[model samples]
Target: MTRSQALTLKSLAIEAYQPGQFEKDLTRAEAARRIQMLRDEIALADSF
Candidate 1:
């Protein structure tokens, strides 16, 4: 993931643990999907 995407993911994670730091919300499945997407993105980039 790029810097921005990583930041968003981090914010989501913080919300998961702390539950109020971020305004935007994601369900458990949504968060899982986004995390997987980032993993895929990073893996693909590293393959270059």
Candidate 2:
């Protein structure tokens, strides 16, 4: 993943309350998918 993507993923993980060390071997696409998933989770939780 690019530095920006990694940072965004980390931020989203924290916001979703799922913070942790991520695998370094993740592909860019995988990182993007995870970031979007995290955003969705955070949005869903906030909608409650």
lDDT of 2 by residue, 1-48 (tens): 999989898888877778763556789999988988888888888999
Cα lDDT computed for each candidate against the true fold: 0.57, 0.83
Lowest summed lDDT window (length 10), candidate 1: 15-24
What's the TM-score of every candidate structure? 0.53, 0.83
lDDT of 1 at 36: 67
Candidate 2 segments whose C-alpha is farther than 4 A from its true place: none
Model 2 TM-score relative to the real fold: 0.83
On the 0 to 100 scale, the lDDT of residue 23 in model 2 is 57
What number of clashing residue pairs does each candidate have, in the order they appear? Answer: 0, 0
**Could you say which candidate leads in TM-score?**
2
Q: Write the per-residue lDDT of candidate 1 for residues 4-47, one digit (tens) a residue.
A: 54467776545445334323466655656776665666666679
